[model samples]
Target: MKAITIKQPWATLIALGEKQFETRSWQTKHRGPIAIHAGKSTDKDACNDSWIKSTLAEHGIKSYKELPTGVVLATAELVDCYKVETTVGHVSVLSNVKVVEGLEVAFGDYTEGRYAWELTNVQVLAKPLEAKGQLSLWEWNGDSK
Candidate 1:
C-alpha cells in the first residue's frame, strides 16, 4: 500500500485525532488508502505545551512517549488533498476518513521520505492493533478491500 511519511508528534497527533490536518507545505494529486507513517523527527518543544497536554487529557489520552516512530501507526484512506483555507467560514476538511486497525510501528525509513511513496513487508505490530476509532477518508484510492 502507498504511505506518506510524516514527522513525529504530528503523526502521533493525527493518529490520536488531536490534530486533523497533516499540514502539507505543498499540494498532492494522489488520493487513496495511505499508511500513516511516523518519522523519527519529533517536535520536542510542542510536546510539553499545556494546550496539547490539556487537549489530549480532555480526550482521555495519555502520554504516548512509549510509542515507537518511523513506522505506520495507523491507516486512513485519503479522500482528497486541498490547500488550507485560513479565511472565515472555511473549515479544513479531510472529508471521509476511515480509520484502519491501529498498529504499533517502529522508527526508521523503508525508503527515503518522498511524496507518493509505496511500501510493503514492513512490520505491523501485533499488539495495539485494535481500532481506536474512525477518521475521515478525504481521497479515495480504491484500496478499501
Candidate 2:
C-alpha cells in the first residue's frame, strides 16, 4: 500500500487516537485505503510532556516504555474518508477504522488538520519498529497527487 511518512509523537497520537487532526500542508483529492505509517523518529520531550502523559494515562497506553528515540510504533488503514461539517468549514475524517494490528486507539478531533481515518484494517508492525508514520493512497488512480 502507498504511504505518507509522519514525524514521531504525532504519529503515536494518530495510533493512540490522541490528536485527531493529521495536519497536512495540502489536501488530498484521492480517497481510499491509506496506510498509517509511523516514522522512525521520536521527540523525547513530547513523550514526557504532561499533556501527552495525562492523555495516555486516560487511554491506558501501556507501551510508553517502549517508545524509544526512533521507531515505527504501528500501522493502520484509512478505510473511509469524508468532509466533516463544522462552524468554519468541512474538514476530513477517516472514519470507522479497525486497529487490526497495533495498540487500541480511540480519540477525537474537531480541527481542520484531520479528524479520523476510515480505518478498515491495521497491523501493529511494531511497538517501536523502524518505520515511518506515513499516509497515502494504496493504488491511487486519481489525477491529483
Candidate 3:
C-alpha cells in the first residue's frame, strides 16, 4: 500500500478520525488506499496547546512521548484533493467543503493556497506496524526501514 509520513500529533489525530483532511502545500492526483504513518518527529509545541493536550489526553495519550511513532497507524482512502480557495479568520474554503471552526481549524494549516487531502474509511491497525517513513507518498512493504 502507499503511505505518507505525518508528524504527531497530526498523525494520531488522523488515525483516530479527529481530523479528516490532511493539508499539504500541493495537490495530488493519486486517489486510493493510503496508509497513515506516524513519523518519528513530534511537534512538541503543537502538543502543548491546551485543547490539543486535552484531546490527546482523552485518547489516553497523556504525554507527547506516548504517541506512536515510526509506525503505520491506520489505512484510509485518499478520496479527494481540494484546493483551499480562501479563508476569513477561521473558516477555510475548499473546493466543495468548508472547515468552519474549532479543532478542524486548529489542527491544520488553512492557508489560502494549500491543498487538503481528504481521507476516509480510516481503519486503525490493531497494533501499529513498525516501519520507517518516507517523505510524500511511499510504498509500505511490511518491514522496518
Candidate 4:
C-alpha cells in the first residue's frame, strides 16, 4: 500500500479520529487507500499544547512518550487535496472552500499555498505493524490484510 510518513502526535491524532486533514507544503495527484505511518520523530512542542495534550488524554495516551512511532497506525482514503488560498483573519478560506475554521483549522497549517490532504474512512490498526518511514509518499511492503 502507498504510505506517507508523518511526525508523531499528528499521526496519532489522525489515527484517533480527532484530525481529519493532513496538511503539507506539497500536493499529490494520487487518490486511493493510503497507510498512515507514524515517524520516529515526535513534535514535542505540539504534544505539549493544552488542546493536543487534552485530546491525547481523552484517548488514554498519557504523554508524548506513549505515542507509537515507526509504525503504520491506520489506513484511510485519500479523498481530496485542497490548496489553501488565504487566511481571512484567523480562518483560512480554501480555494475549494468558502470558509474553514475551528478544530480543522487548528489541526493543520492553513497557510496559503499549502495543501490539505482530505482523509476519510480511517481504520486504525489494533496492533500497529513496525515500518521505517521515508519522506513524501512511499510504498509500504507490509500486508495490510
Candidate 5:
C-alpha cells in the first residue's frame, strides 16, 4: 500500500475524518486507498493553537497525549489532487464539504502553489501499526487492519 507521513494533529485529524484534504507542495498521480501515517515529529505550535485544541475537543480528542506517532493510524482514499490559483478558490473547494472553518485552516495551507490531496472513505485503525515513514508517498507492507 502507498503511505504518506504527516505531522501530528493533521494526521490525527485525517484519521478522525475531520480533514478532507492533505495539502502538499507537490502533486501525485497515484489514487486509491493509502495509509495515513503519523510521523514521529509533532507540530508543537499547531498543538498549542486554541482553535486546534477546540476542534480536537469537538472530535473527542481532549489532548495530544493520546495521538499516535510513527505509525499508520488509518487509511483514506486519495481521490484527487489539485491546486487553486487563489486563496478564495482554495477555501471554496471545501464549501460543499462539511468542515469546520478552524479545521480548514488547521489542515491546509491555501497558498496558490500548494496542492490539495483529496481523500475519502477514511477508516481509522483499531490499533496503530508502528513504522518508519519516508518523505512523500512510500510503500507500506503492513496490513491496514
Candidate 6:
C-alpha cells in the first residue's frame, strides 16, 4: 500500500472523516487506496487555533493526546486532485468543480496554486501500525491484511 505522512490534528481530522481534502503543493497521479500516517511531529500552532479546536471538538476529539502519531492511522481512497482557486470574499472552489466551504476551510488553504487531494471511504485502523514517515507518497511494504 501507498502511504502519506501528515501532521497531527490534520491527520486525525482526516482519519475521522471530518476532513475530505488533503492540500499539497504538488499534485499526484496515483489514485487508489492509501494509508494515512500521522507523523511524529505535530502542528502545535494549528492545534491551538480556534477553528481547529472547535472542529475537533465537534468530532469528539477533546485533546491532541487523543490523536495517534508515528503510525498508520487509517486508509482511504485518493479519488481526485485539483487546484484550489479562490476569489474575493473567501469564495473558494476547485479548478474542476465546486467544493463545500466547510470542507475547504477544514482541510485546505483555499488559495490558488495548492492542490486538493480528495479522499473518500476513510477507514480508521483498529490497531494503528507503527511506522516511520516519509515526505511524499511512499510505498508501505508491511502487511495490510
Which parts of model 6 have CA positions greater than 4 angstroms off?
A: 87-90, 143-145
Task: Look at candidate 3 and tell me the lDDT of residue 39.
Answer: 94
lDDT of 4 at 27: 94
Q: Scored by Cα lDDT, where does model 4 land?
A: 0.89
**Tens digit of per-residue lDDT, candidate 1, span 1-145:** 5566666665665666554445444556666666676665666555566666565566565565744565557666665543332221222222233221111111111111211222222333343222222232232232322
What's the CA RMSD of model 5 in angstroms? 3.5
lDDT of each: 0.45, 0.47, 0.88, 0.89, 0.81, 0.83
TM-score quality measure for candidate 5: 0.86
Residue 121, model 5, lDDT: 96
> Against the hidden reference, what TM-scores do the models get?
0.54, 0.48, 0.93, 0.93, 0.86, 0.89
Q: Go through the candidates in order and give the C-alpha RMSD of each one to the true structure.
A: 11.7, 8.4, 1.5, 1.9, 3.5, 2.2
Candidate 1 whole-model C-alpha lDDT, 0 to 1: 0.45
Supply the TM-score for candidate 3: 0.93
Q: How do the residues 1-145 of candidate 3 rate in per-residue lDDT, one tens digit apiece? A: 8899999999999988888889999888999999999999999999999878988888889999899999999999999998888877768888887554667777888788899899999999998999988888889976555
| Pairs clashing within candidate 5 | none
As for TM-score, the candidate ahead, 1 or 4, is: 4
Q: What's the candidate order when arranged by decreasing lDDT?
A: 4, 3, 6, 5, 2, 1
Off by over 4 Å in 4: 143-145
TM-score of 1: 0.54
Model 4, 1-145: lDDT tens per residue? Answer: 8999999899999999998889999999989999999999999999998888999999999989999889999999998888999876558887666567777788788899998898999999989999988998999977633
Model 3, CA-based lDDT: 0.88
Give residue 127's lDDT in candidate 5 (0 to 100).
Answer: 89
Tens digit per residue, CA lDDT, model 6, 86-105: 63344567787766475446
Which parts of model 3 have CA positions greater than 4 angstroms off?
97-100, 143-145
Clashes of each: 14, 23, 0, 0, 0, 0
